[model samples]
Target: MIRPDHPASFLEEGPFRTEEDQYFWKALVELTAMEETNQGNLAAFVGVSQGYVSKILAGKQVPKARLRRRFAEFFELAYEDMVALGRQHLESMGYPAEGLPGRRCQVREPAYGGAEAAGRPAAGQGEYSALRSMVRDLRAREAREGTYTEIPLREATASMGGGSTETGDRTLSYLSFRTEWIRSKGNPEYMTAIRAFGDSMEPTIADGSVVLIDEGRRQFVKNKVYYLRYNGQMYIKRLVDAGGRLGIASDSDNNLLLVSDADDFEIIGRCIWTARELD
Candidate 1:
């Protein structure tokens, strides 16, 4: 850690009462020393001028509110530390410390990989293991409960193209509707809600609408709306068999899309249902 060579009393002054100011000064000095570079190098790293760095270090200039947060983030200082340091500096200079950010701690639930390996040793697995564990636990819990938790059958059914299935030995067919609900039991497949942003699929699926997609469904069907992954972004389009090769088309227009290689594109999921808000 690069300690400021100046006395702490020097920082006690006007405009440094906020915690953000303390974090900014500390982060700036630390970052400058960590790189073993002068004000010029520090300025370039933070997208500022060398004079700006010097002015800040000398307490001759006060950074704006926006840049204070950015500086704290760049230096990886804790929120409380940033605020506390600012208060100390401001108080020393006879300035009133106002609206300092309170200390906050965040707790995150641990993720699991599978049932058989529940809470087992898995290093470097991170989110992957946690997801697997959650799925396994959910399935086991649902099976023990012995009930099909009701989901939005309308939305779910619409997304899956309204296929009816007989539940076990029951004579009556249980109707499922596609909705935005998921069962709390079973080995349920992962689904994601994505907001449409472009006018590529206008009219049928307008921009700013939300679509529910099942990531597990990679199979393509002719003339059905599906989420297609190409390049790095995902697009929703209808897949059609043009002659002997696969061709994609937009629903708003009848124009056929140009295809170079089928391997480059991947079918992410069939569009189950879309939710749009009226203006």
Candidate 2:
């Protein structure tokens, strides 16, 4: 709902392209406005001067050198995630980022919370000291250009059975993995994480499993589970390519839907990884 006061044409050229830079800075401003007192509060949070924050917000500058770590830290985002935003700088400057970072800053030492802080060190310098490695990793990630990509996990769940289910439209968060780690599996950029609902797939894919989908692999592949949308509802089913037609199979021994045309349903993506809590 919040629009930028200045258009991209009016912004100064800096570390990031105009639109990308604005999204980064604007998001920070809006997200923290509720928790921070002002630009000064945010500046203090990142160990930067208020003017620096103003320049960034006004699209006059970008986080330079080690400031990236500090900025990520303020957001409690990891060095990898912060650097990922400036990937163009990485590619242009020849920064290597093979491993992908991609998490928020180290666990907050009570000062912050979230997955990053789940097992963080106790209060004080102990925690800050641990962050040095994160900063170092971030530096490497930036310098080498990350090899991993972040796949968003929409808070939405894709149904695997039980008729139909609504999908989550909002991106709740992200999960990062090594591009090399999954390249053999599929295109890293085509990846996304969605929760599974219902019991159509059951034992093979539990009702609460976190399913990783390859958005690029929409074409039917035999015996492989894929994310599909039918009748405005989403479902995950093992599909087979029968010449020009498609056949969807459920692991729960349910009946299959045989289609004479490939366009009968929408292929959201292919399931690559399935993670679920063990009872």
Candidate 3:
């Protein structure tokens, strides 16, 4: 088992015993540990399912280089460092890089913004026009820097238990955040905010909280919370697929349902993020 002390300890466990992906696993472990959260949080932060995270950790899968680079930068690795790490991983494994994710590029954080990095230039017509265009584009993007999409907040509440879902067609307003930012955290295009009711989900998803849901993700996945609708009521529950049946579990003791089939139910989405006020 990988521990915090060893950093890349997971590389030595299970299928990772082979050298094919030890280096990549090492880098991944380091990156995931940076946020001080468990594998589940890492999966959420990287916008993937927990099972997918497990595969990567186990050396059963190699993610696209674009994804690897994104997470690398998220963990503050310079593009140069990122590429170096990849090459080092392959070398340590003694594997040919014939088939791999993607080529590495020299990526780095911006030290200084814009043309200033090129040093001061003599005043010229061409330079003047270029400067003008750059400034214009910068201002436009700065105004929209957050890159957010407006997700409608519905008046309907997803009852954990006891409480009934409000079948109203009310969309009070919208919740906005950077499309890329939350997409990096979860599915951006399918994200929406919901109001939680009751306490069945408890500590995981508390009563009267606002939670983010990824409508694009509706598969009944283990260890991930999902929004479900059944029997004229709505709920936020975790699903466990058991052969031909579905096992529903909740953080609170009150709600647990095992069904041979949840065909009568409709899955809304996967719950990606949740926020409950202290009041």
Candidate 4:
């Protein structure tokens, strides 16, 4: 049986021991003192009450064994430093040093089919499914209202070479920010931003126009514009539910795209607002 009085004795009996035990302990103490200058910081790092740090520093109480490794990691001290410190403290008190507490490892059972075989759904699949449903409901509501929200615009003038009234004025423009325009009402999750692409949305969303997207809605509405993703690429398009089948369409044209594989598309957010520059 190993003596618990000396911490170093535990190392001799165990498979692991540090050669520079004394130096390691001194380094650990110095590091702890340097970083943990106040009781509050020390308590937070050690996950203990502030009173505990004061008690330990004042030599009124010995730190619990649970704190040893935590202190080592928080202070960035080496394993050898922790062992050396424990050994020194035991020797000074004329007590036996016991080995470190054993750590438990958790083992999980293998999934029914291995991780690869489980076939996890691609990212954003759940969100897209939810958005598609919501769009369907929103379209019904919009039909009752009989009118659509108008997008706002901004204007800017382009400078021509050399000031001359004879030359026609050139202008560049875009959408104005609608911070105060969106009432949001009681729905906190509703948000709006300019949509800036047309790869999947074409006529519905011009490349330069801003789009407003809502983070709250999770249902899909057939034949409504939505921000979507296929593979890793992002797209905005109108999604239509052809019975159980999914079809994608661009706002610019009437052609429809079939989406058989769920991995091919993802809904990033719903288009709630759009801004275009007036010519």
Please tell me which predicted candidate would have the highest lDDT against the true structure: 2
Computed on alpha carbons, the lDDT of every model, listed in order, comes to: 0.50, 0.62, 0.61, 0.46
Model 2 lDDT at residue 48:
80
Residue-level lDDT tens digits of model 4 in 18-37: 43433233333334443324
Q: 54 in model 3: Cα distance from truth in Å?
A: 59
Instruction: Please state the error at residue 137 of candidate 3 in Å.
Output: 14
Every candidate's CA RMSD: 20.3, 15.9, 19.3, 23.7
Query: 1-279, model 2: which lDDT tens digit per residue?
Result: 222333233244344544444335533433343233356767888788988777665545667647756776676556556544444322433323332111121111122233234363333335333333544566576544456667798876787775456676688888777767878888776778988887889788988899999899887668888888876677888887656567778888867777654444788888988888688
Which regions of candidate 4 are displaced past 4 Å? 1-181, 184-195, 199-203, 262-264
Q: What is the lDDT of residue 202 in candidate 2?
A: 75
TM-score, predicted candidate 4 vs. hidden true structure: 0.33
lDDT string, candidate 1, 27-56, tens digits: 344333333334554566667786776677
Best to worst by lDDT, what's the order? 2, 3, 1, 4
Which stretches of candidate 2 lie above 4 Å from their native place?
1-148, 241-245, 260-264
Clashes of each: 17, 19, 0, 31
TM agreement with the true structure for every prediction: 0.34, 0.48, 0.46, 0.33
